[model samples]
Every structure is written in structure tokens, then in C-alpha cells.
Target: MIKFAYTILYVQDVQRSLEFYETVFGFTRKFITPDNSYGELITGDTTLSFAAHDLAKSNLKDGFMKSSNDNKPFAMEIAFSTDNVEALYEQAIKAGAIAEKPAEYKPHGQTVAYVRDLDGFLVEICTPME
Candidate 1:
């Protein structure tokens, strides 16, 4: 059976990205490479991972767009479901995530907010859909 396992974000600093997620989302470290080129977090069934930009480049022959705080975030986002969207959103901002939008209730009955991670990747803080 096919199963979704993990999502790895290419980042300039794998260690720094791992620490940001740990500090803001409270996910524990699973493992990191000896060279600090890659790391994973214990984020439930689907692990959240990070890989150093150089490592990522080596894996992909054509190269890829690198995330940056100076650029607008990409269209996609990684979402974290929580009971307290507001609190988590606040904590993310305090941990160096740029606020893209404040927490607000959606017409569909979910509370959602948006932020950009240190690497400029979009992140969604939201309540579970009932």
C-alpha cells in the first residue's frame, strides 16, 4: 500500500530549520546527519524533514528554486492542525516566522492563519476540520 511518509524542505541551514520547527511547533528531533546536511522531526505518521540546500542540489540535477525571506512565498504550504490556532500563530511569529495573516475563523468553520518560515516557505496554522 502506498502511504505518505514525509515532507522535506530544502533549506539553507538544516539545523536552524530544525530548531525553528522544534521551538515553534514543539516537535522533537528524530535524527540529523553527522554533517548537519539533513534532519527529521518526530511529527506523527508523516515526518517533517529538512535538507541542506547543497545536499538538495546534489540530489536534483536540474537544480531548484531556493526559498528566501526576501522573496514572496511559494503557492504551497505546510499546515499544522492545533486546538489553539491563535496561540500557535503567535508563537510562530515570535520564533522568527513572518506573519502573512492573523488567525481568523473561516466561513467553513475552521480557524486558520498563515506565516512564512525563516526560509520563506508558507505555513498554515489551523484548527482541525470538524
Candidate 2:
């Protein structure tokens, strides 16, 4: 017996990541601890958990990793599906995120681009192409 649902990614800075998700992807805050050590963001049924780097490592194999990693040319980016692409893209730019590629409509029916969050995670925000 097994259930399929939910995902949690290790984030570097809780406030920074919270800002990026809330501003860029329009995720609402589920909860934020006063110490800024733990928080959760919700977009519909999706739950994004943000745990402090120091705490995260301790939870690992005797604190294997000390910090969050900046996925460069290796790890896959997290893709978020949205109804509005351009608006979110612009908002992300205003939020101090660096956009590697400007948003563009594709023949494959997607208006998409990539933006780097505070921790260097690539986020792909997209909608159907025009």
C-alpha cells in the first residue's frame, strides 16, 4: 500500500525562497515560523517546504550536506504550469531573479523561459503558446 503525492525541496534561505515563490509563481504562504527557520508555501495542492540549511544538513546522513546546491548544467529545473506566463515572468524579473532567456512563444504550445531563484534553482514558468 502506497500513496502518491507531495514534494519537498531543500532550500537555502527560507525568506528568499519564500519571496521568490510567492512573488514569481504566486504561491500563497501556508505558514512561516517566527525565527525564519521553517515555512511552507502552497499553490493549489502543491506544497513547497522550506527548511533552514543548518537544520536540513542535520536531518541528512549525519549532516552529509552543509548547504543547498546551485544546480548549473546538471540538475533539471522545476517546471511550474500556469495560466499566465508573461505576467509571472516579468514579476520574477522584478523580484531580483535573473532570467537566462526571455519569454517566448513556442510552436510546441508553450510560452516559457528560465529564471534563477536565490539559491540558483532554475524555475521554468510556462503557459500555452500563442
By lDDT, who's the top model here?
A: 1
Summarize candidate 2's per-residue lDDT along 1-130 as a digit string, tens digits: 6653455556667887888788777789998889888888886555777788777777787663322234452266777877877778778889877777878888787888887766666778888445
The C-alpha RMSD of each candidate to the native structure, in angstroms, is 0.6, 3.0
lDDT of 1 by residue, 79-120 (tens): 999999999999999999999999999999999999999999
Off by over 4 Å in 1: none
How displaced is residue 52 in candidate 1, in Å? Answer: 0.2
For candidate 2, the TM-score is 0.78
Q: For each of the candidates, give the backbone clash count.
A: 0, 2
